[model samples]
Target: MNEHILLVNPWIYDFTAYDLWMKPLGLLYLASHLKNSGYKVTLLDCMDRHYPFMPLPDHPGPKRLKSVGCGSYYREKIPKPAQFLSIPRYWSRFGIPWDEVKKQLKEIEPPGWVFITGTMTYWYPGQVAFLNLVRQLWGKTQVIIGGWYPTLCSEHAHQWGFDRIIEGIDPLLVIKQLSSDFKELSTITGYKEFFSVKPAFDLYKKLDYTVVLTSIGCPFRCTYCASGRYFSEFWRRPWEQVLDEITYDYENYRIQDLAFYDDALLYRAEESFLPLLKALQKERLPLRFHLPNSIHARYVTREIAELMRECNFETLRISLEFSDVDSQKNTGNKVDNFIFEKAIQSFIQAGYAPEELEVYLLFGLPGLKAKDYELSIEYVTDLGLKPRLSLFSPLPGTPDFEKVIMHQIKDDPLFQNKIAYLYLSEQNELYEALQRKISKYTFFH
Candidate 1:
């Protein structure tokens, strides 16, 4: 019999969280990799909003899901962790109840190894809770944790005491390392083998949508982004592989709403992304594409805009991190005024409702006054685009984060939490006020 491997997506313990086209794609990819290697794989997503028996005994059921497949998670109020006690918000575990999780785990066979995924470096407490539960039931099961938390903050990760920690963003690299350590695991290497297999989306009985990454890394090294740190150089999948995955998603999973998790999908739009869009257009699979991750404004050409509309792009969000024209010109970090405005106009001309498009504006940066956000909100609203306040929280692996963040965040991932950052910096009030201001400004426009 094949050895069993359990893939667990831990709950998110935070002030607030919403499932905005989010899924544990990295872990699911590993599930496919291991299953291909002749291991039986199982997934236990604590954050699954569509968990079959959703409206269990006392629950009001999960929050309503939007037509676009993005909405609230099933959350329950929980005590704020000691580190977060200083912050005055009610914390919650944004997922299924722990009691329900325990009841479900009882039915599963004890696996040889357990794989858990980490996100938002600070959200490790949920992982700990799951691990503790597993320890009682499946004693000695080797638990390997991966994703940004371990890769970015290894020191902080080690404190969690998981059996193994696989660092880095590349799933193939993680599999390669595991194969070297334990020959029983998959022996794949590089992107070639990685893309050959589809992610184990079938592991779920149902899915709201599926996420696809046509490329890895990003070309632009924006000061606030960690893309450069992770990939160093940009790389996109072969045209054949991406096309295959998209078609497979539609055929196998009926995935109408496909979200692109690419950091920079439009970097080389014509060659890298356009061909895929054109192929999807030709196929006309009745798929609606989304970009939860913002795309580059500089690369949003009129033709690309038109093609995106033709391809049924729903969330056409672009990065307009700030409205400081002088800063943009001097830094060349973000797109210039001419390019940004042109992109918006192209989208409008492409038949996208001006209200449907979202323009992300970075807020909460150290030394960035609320007045800066006021100007950005005004600028974005004036253009008839919804202003999304992008939080300027520290990401450990990013160069900018290392330079300015305090030793506290460096020592403990808890301090890296977004809400924690706002309060610690004494700017929580400003962020809240800006949010209200953005909503008020964008309402009429």
Candidate 2:
């Protein structure tokens, strides 16, 4: 008999979060593999808005969905976590309520094994809550947790009582380990190659959007980023496979929003992105696409911009690490002012408005000056693009990790605060002052 496996996509607990076409691509891929291996796969998405037990809002209407398949979640105010009580923001659970999750688990009658996915280190509370509920219901069942948070903080996850925590993108070794212990589990074959399996979007009651990864890993090794360490190799799916997945999501699931989760979507445009875009254009499906992950500036040529415009890319973000040339090289000379300017011009010529173009500015980094980011914000705004400030969080393995150690900032008690602004060590106080000065342009406003 095929053993049953349950995949759980847990709720997001945060001060604020939006569905920017985000989906657990890793977990979904695992689910597809398990199904192909003859396991009865059941997915419990706690983020489902159409969950039967969800409370009816005071207002009556189909939920307000933005054109790009990006919008709000069903949120309910919850008490702040004990450690985060000092923060003034009202923390809420962003998904179907806890009662609904419990109801769904009971209805599913549990499974042979439970797998949970997580992202962002601070978002661990949601994963922990889901795991606790799972433990209460099926004490004997094995629980495995993986994803960004676990990959970054495995020790913390082990301390939380997760039966096993797998780090890194490859799951073959972990599967082998599990099989050794379970003895009766089916073997997963041909795991080394990048497998093409449609995400289990059908498992959700209502699919608002789906995330697709046409490629994995980035070629550049930016000093502060964990991309190189996480992936270790640059691999891309064939254009046909990527397009087929897109078509499958659109035709079968009626999904209108598709987000690409690739770190380097436009690495080699002529060979990779262009062919994919042309394929999408040829299909001419009424679909809205998004690139939440930043795109390489040098790759955004006039033709590419026009292609993107034709494909109905509703939201796009380009990475502009710093305005200063010195800082640019320090970060990763991915692109310079000339490339950025040309890219913005091409995007504008292709029909994107100033407000639609977002340039991500890395706000805090060890040894960085407050004026550095302020100048970057000014530079991006002067170019008629929206400046999106991304707070810096130090990961375990990166060139910047040595910098953090040298500066002794990573050991600080408050280093984990995503908004704490610890990266400006040289001008710490000045950084806070500068942040207040730039508060007007913040996304919340």
Candidate 3:
């Protein structure tokens, strides 16, 4: 008998949540692998916007959806977690209702095992709530929790009532563990290559848009980033394979909006990105691509910019963490003003207007002056590019993680909340003023 496995993308319990092309790519990847390995797999995405329960009383009237299948999730305002009571914000569980979750769980077959994956350590409250519900309905089943939350907060996550917790991104180890549950399981070979099974996007009730990852890992180890930690070695899929996935989505589901979830999407232009882009342009599929994760500013040459334009990239955000020379050097020398300017000009020449070009600016880094952040915003805006301010949240295992020293941050993951930190009201006058100053920018305001 095939072992029935249940995969879950748990609820996001936060003060605010939005669908920024966010999907459970990891869970889907796991689902595909399990199906290929001759196991039955099911996904319970609590955050599913297309959840069959229609006209939820909490959300009345027309659904508010936005560009490229990105929009709001069904939400219900819940009481703030005790730790977050100090911050004056309405907390909500972003996803289907509890009643609906119970109904869905009752409908599924008794699974041989359950796997839960989540991101963002601060959102563990949702995981706790989810596990409580699972325990109530399913009894004491074998539950495995993984993803960034468990990987970063293994010690903190132990109290959360999981049977096992996989610490890293190794699916092979997970499979080996699963073999113990089923006596008939045979030794699996070429498991790494077996991950090529098309992600189980078919599992969803409806398809709006899809996400693709042409590459994994990153070349640079920035001080405040955990991408390198998650993926030890940098690797890229063949362009043909990537193109096949995109074409599958386009042909079967009529999905036009595609997002790239790569850390170093444009690291080696000729080998990985360029060939893929050229193939996409040649195919001339009427599809729109988005890079929610910003691309390296220094890598954007004139030719690359043109290729992006031709390939129907609807949204482009350049990673320009800071314009200051010292700050640039401090953050792995990711981007310099000269290179940024060249990229901007090339983008302009390739037909991107000022409004279309968005530049990301990092705010609230330790030892960074408020004036430097202000100047960086001003510099980007002066160059006719939109400045997008991203607050810095220290991730565990990153180079800068050891340097954080504000109000028991190291002890609790909740302190990792970047936006909520502004509401703490304990910051210095200069830091508060800088927050107020950035608020004036129309993009944020």
Candidate 4:
């Protein structure tokens, strides 16, 4: 098919991958804006779980038990890059294979422009492979890359020879940047004009779940987080318009599960978030909401917790990164023990069982010890909630990035791998042992 623009969500190459209601909301939103602007846009999402030819007879895996848009991608084992060869975990390409991708691409005529989304910094190898293929098929096309990877590692992304590298989270910048090349966005001033329009999710033949952004940027400046770098200040989308988008997806698309990809969904409970929740509760919809992004523990008030339960917020992951006093204070003092326990109690009182909740406790942070992880895990499990052990990856622009930059992997984005960062070079076997021990301990409890 011919189109004015093409949006591609590249495959993910990692030690492991899972689909937890994943979709390229950024590209989809751009598709909506471009289409409304009188351009035909098509999406080539390699990670799409609902592909027509997926789940082949005796497939590698039969789309591993999708539960409300959460499941596994059709992954095949691919060779790991040389840098990651030290890490003994099996590397896989987590998406549709290239032959199927070729079949899809063969149908489409070369477009006027191609906008590709970049995710994790380490996942660029997947983009690299896909980029090579796109270049070979449609040489010299305008292929602009954007999203977290290009934003965080622009210098590295520039090496790949993209026509343009769009940085930052301002959706206005999308049209603004494209205008520089194609001479179209001079009439557009800000993102407000498109704020009311829903993302082009209707472009999909099937959408199991949808993701929404109620706010841009974050209010807190956590040292390990890059939110402040992505957006200089916190800005809330007009809650009414946001509510309209959510309900439109619910009613029109027949979508029942919605995920909020906001950096801070509850910065100030009295303002946008609370009102949005109240409006949603009033709708009496059976939609299940999820906050996979860590909700600030500081903002969880009794009323907020109660409203969350009322609105059917299914997945509640708290951002209680550190377990101790000083470390907790280091995390922008977002949540202290009293506040953390209070939030849990508030949710419990609001009809949530502790195990139904998940608490994120960071492991392998600079000063943390294995005992610290053990205590942190015990702390969450003791509260009757599950503990999510997140390995620390030093994202560029975060304060911690400097500490890791001194190492050799600084030249390679693969060094920033979240799961295998603890197992780099000479330290591999040691941390590998530690990972095994931690997994064993976790399974034990």
Candidate 5:
């Protein structure tokens, strides 16, 4: 029997969305597992900006490509959800058209099961739309939904029309569940073969860039972050396996850019990162790495910084979540001013330009004042480092979520959108002022 499974990366229905070399990595990993289990797998990326089937008018052209693999998405302004009607900005469905999605589904043979991956809780509208479409086409086919959204808001995910919902980040948990349900478990000869299975990146039509997760979960328990909640365990993968994955993509696909999705890239660097960097340097590949997730400032030792420079670390971001002592203590004390200073100095001494080293300053906390953000920006600018503001989104299962009033959320996941929901007057004023101030000091290096 030909047991085929359809994997879907749903669209982003929001006020704004961007492709920071984003991919449904979990779904791709699942695809590889299914393929190994003797089931045919197909991926339908609804948010594929490069999909040629649905082309936009040449008059406007597609949103201009920015940087090597990061750029804007094809956005179509849609009516805002009833709850977000008061918000001024236009709501958009950021992805290919609905007709194109249906067309792609029709091209493939009907599968026995449709596996859909969910991202942010606020983006549930996209998942709902995807599930509705899947039902229309394959009435009796099983629909299994999983990922961050279902894991964080399992109760809420039930309303999305999924036949079954799986939570947590364990790939083995998923495999075991499927095997028990289907009664056709693939024979696992040994642990070596299991860990050797790579993500099915070949499923994509064209690969612009890929994401890597060398380490799972995070060591620090930040109040605002749900990293610990999602994984609940901190573990690093084998460096040899990581190296093989990177080289495979580089040699086979000619991929130049790789985005690291690790929550703690620099945690215990001597054990994981140090060896990985040394190996990459030995290979002398012309590939550039991007750390989209900020690293621990304290972990940025002089030696690590020097090694990163040698390996062509194109984008380096360190987390300086807050400046004040109270705020720093409240949210995990990942980096203090003293530690941050040393890390910045190390990068600069290692020949990294100011623009190349961006420090992330968090904003939009419940009790945080605008002055806190202003002082932090001033400190980062004074030290000649670029400031990248990461607005806070109150995710369920985070420490900060308990501090706020859940009644205000009203069970609407849309309230989880930081841009649309966290619109405090003071934060808004500070954000705008900082944007204007930083615009004058813009330098590319």
Candidate 6:
């Protein structure tokens, strides 16, 4: 008999988290590969907003989901972790209740192995919690954990007791490692052999949106980013495969919202994104697309913007880390005034509403003054786009980690919590002053 495998996308424990077209693309890809190789795959998405067992909370209705399918997550309040006791905000687990998760696990038969995926480095507590529950229910069933958190903070993950941990996006290597260790568990399936298989979206109880990756890794190496560390090499899949995945989701699954999780989607657009967009236009499927992971501003030319609009791009976000050109160059020449202005104008001319486009402004970098972020926010707002403040989480592998350590911010465990002003010194009043300025500016409302 073929092996039964369980794949889980763990919850996010944070001060604030939204669905924002998020999905475990990597884990689902593995599930698809395993299923195609004759394994019975079961997916447990803890972040499923439409989970049927939970009672609906008294909250606002769903946000304006575009015709293509991107929307929000159902949220509930939970106690903040002990480390964040100093922070005066309610930190919640952004997913289903613990009881519901346990109940679902109880219903499943003993599997050969369980695969778990992680996200933000600071959100490892969620992964730990999920693993603990799995241990409780399955009693020594081998669990494998991988993704951004494990790949970046492998040392920390070892303490969490996962039987095996794989890093990076090399699915073939991971399968080999799993096969060698758990030969009795299942038959080995190489990545090339499973290339044609689609992700097991059918295992999901509710399909809000589907995530697709046309490429992996990024060409540029930014000091503050972990993209290079996670992917290590840039590789683009065939355009036809991308189109087929989109079409399959639209036609067969009735999935309208598709999010591209590529770190570099727009780079070399003539060869990469353009062909895919043209193919999509030719098909004229009534579907909407999103780039939740910010795209490269340097490549967003007017032609690309028009093509994106023609291909039904519903939501897009561009990374505008700093308004100061010198600061931006110091971090990485990821954006320049020329590129920024052109990208903004191209999207505007391409018929995207100002509100539909957002510019992510990184807040709380070491040595950055409160006035600097204030100016950055104002600059993005002046560009006729929403300024979304992405609080900087100091990952272990990023250049910022040494800076953070030198500053002794990590000395206090509370500093590891991303939501807190980690870069600010305990005696520094800059954080409170910046918070006041942000509140006074009031643009997102």
lDDT of 5 by residue, 1-445 (tens): 5688889888899877888779887678768867877788888888877788656522342342355677677777888878776667878888888788888788889988988887788888888888899899989889988777787888988876688888765555555565655555445332344456788999887888888878877888889998865554667888889899999988877888998888889998888889999999899988888988888888888988998999998888888977788888878888899999999999999999887887898877778776777888888888877788888888888878777664556477778888765552225667777777766666531
User: Per-residue lDDT tens digits of candidate 1, residues 232-313?
Assistant: 4677887778888889888998877999999888887767688887887898888888888888888888889999999999
Off by over 4 Å in 1: 56-65, 182-186, 329-332, 403-407
Instruction: TM-score each candidate.
Output: 0.93, 0.87, 0.92, 0.92, 0.93, 0.89
The root-mean-square deviation over C-alpha atoms between each candidate and the true structure, in angstroms, is: 2.5, 4.0, 3.0, 2.8, 2.7, 3.3
Local accuracy by lDDT, each model: 0.80, 0.74, 0.79, 0.77, 0.79, 0.75
Candidate 6: tens digits of C-alpha lDDT, residues 31-95: 87666667888888888777787555445435575334544455567877665677667777778
Tell how far residue 351 is off in model 3, in angstroms: 0.8
Tell me the tens digit of each residue's lDDT in model 3 across 219-253.
88889998866765677788898899999989988
Pairs with backbone N, CA or C atoms under 3 Å apart (clashes), candidate 5: none
Global local distance difference test of model 3: 0.79
lDDT of 6: 0.75
Worst 10 residues of 5 by lDDT: 57-66
lDDT of 2 by residue, 1-445 (tens): 5788889888888776766677777677777767776789998777666666777532333343455565567788898656555555777888888887787789885687898887776677788888899889998888888776777766666778888877765444445555654443335543334255676777777777888887767888898887756764676678888888889888898978888888889887777689989988988999988888999988888999999999998778998888999988887788899999999999999999887887888866777776677788788766656777677777656777667643433443224445433423333455567556556555544
